[model samples]
Target: MTKPTLADLTAFSAVATHRSFRRAADALGVSRSSLSHAMLALERDLGVRLLNRTTRSVSPTEAGEALLARLAPVLRDLDDALDAVADARGNPSGTLRINANESAARLLLKTVVPLFLKRFPSMALDLVAEGRLVDIVERGFDAGVRLGESVPRDMVAVRISDDLRFVVVAAPSYLSGRTPLITPDDLRNHDCIRQRLPSGKRYRWEFRKHGEEMAIDVPGVLTLDHNGLMVEAASDGLGLAYVPESTARDWLDDGRLVTVLEDWCPFIPGLCLYYPGHRHVPAGLRAFIDVLREVNH
Candidate 1:
């Protein structure tokens, strides 16, 4: 048994966290070959295979997962301690990674991002936007932004925006000949731009009014994954798009798109910035949260 250097252990954690040498190397600002060799040396020192590497992909072995589970908290504590010292000196400086769905990302970009960067000139933000809901802890993100209801129960959430509403919008040309749209069921008669969830399921158009609720798996000639794209399609008169009101706000205000079923689309919960409750919130993350509240209020 031999003691591995702190740097080697840190690199091992990064590789295990990402499950890809190239990704870990890029994040660590090292070459892939060097990272691979380092991982190999780490495994040899421990007398256990930590990662199962293939030509196409890499994954942590059972032992690697166990080590990572214990190592993550230790490394996080060290980071927090360092961040505290840095905070004592002045503005926090580090990269803050956030994973968010497209809608939430757009909201953050519009509201929190610019000010946070301007306020802390040394801080860097990596905002990854996609349709998928990822495990922020496992994926190595400082936080995640999603609608309040979608946040995992174990995490602490802070509201970043006002309550959001989803509305059905269409170009006037597309609405002209369509029958008066009233209820959720009426969508069947009109072409809609269907939204595809990251899980490969078509989103069921949900509506609530007068204590009645309905989820319609609306029919559509076109299916799109992103809300912004759906809004664009609807503006092109392709079909009705169900999207966040903010995403469609510009078009709605300029008369490029008109809303229908507004009564059925009542305000729901707003976007939230969430993170694991157990881990220490780094200085950069704390400062970032401050910016969110400042911009939000």
Candidate 2:
């Protein structure tokens, strides 16, 4: 069998790591079609099928997974060695992958991402936006961003935002015919657009006032997974939604939606960018954190 080139090995690893050619290509700054062709050529040259591809998904075969198990650490070490040389010169250069929620990612794009890119033009970043809180270490990400309250205890977190509040909101049309929402208990008399947690459980609406706290499994026929979607549903008069106050601000301003039970909602912890405390922080990641601190401060 012909030996695979270094580029081939790295491309295969990237595809397997991302489980999609499109994402892998974006990470590598290549086109998906070219990446796909490279994988086919690499597999043919090695006389082994490394990837199982479908229209919607991709997975590494057993042989591919075994090769990746050994190859990944070697590639990571190679990157670190190269980055170390750059770091010595005070230049952080390498791919920095961050797994982040949509909200946090948006916040970073507005405040942190541009500055980091402009300052470290030689470096690259892959910010994967999703709602689920994933295991960043296992997923091969340099870091992850999430709400401070949701960050794992073991990781080192850099605060990116201040306290935030989640409020209950409904369209004025929906609220007009319903019983007055003076307290959390009155939510049971109306339809609530329930939020589905990442873990496949419905998020219980939480409320607190004075010394009393309540978690309500709100009544509703419709359930949505995203806060943005929940806010849209509430705006459409489908049902009431519990969402970030900032997310509902525009709708509230336009008279499409109005807040209820405002006395119950309280400010909670803000967003954070977190990483594994045990591993060596990549130079690019450290640089990014510095930028975060500078911007957020």
Clashing pairs in 1: none
Give the alpha-carbon lDDT of every model.
0.90, 0.91
Model 1 poorest ten-residue lDDT run: 20-29
TM-score of each prediction: 0.87, 0.76
lDDT, candidate 1, equals 0.90
In terms of lDDT, model 2 sits at 0.91
Per-residue lDDT value at 38 in model 1: 88
What TM-score, to 2 decimals, does candidate 1 have? 0.87
Best by lDDT: 2
Which residue ranges in model 2 land beyond 4 Å of their true spot?
1-79
lDDT of 1 by residue, 1-297 (tens): 678999998999988888878778756768999999988888888999999999988999999899999998898789978998978987899899999987778888888898999989989998888678888876778899999989999999999878989999999999886689978899998899999999999999999999999999999879998888999999999999999999999999999999999999999989899999988888899999998888877
**Model 2 per-residue lDDT at 1:** 87
TM-score of 2: 0.76
Error of 1 at 68 (Å): 4.5
Clashes of 2: 0
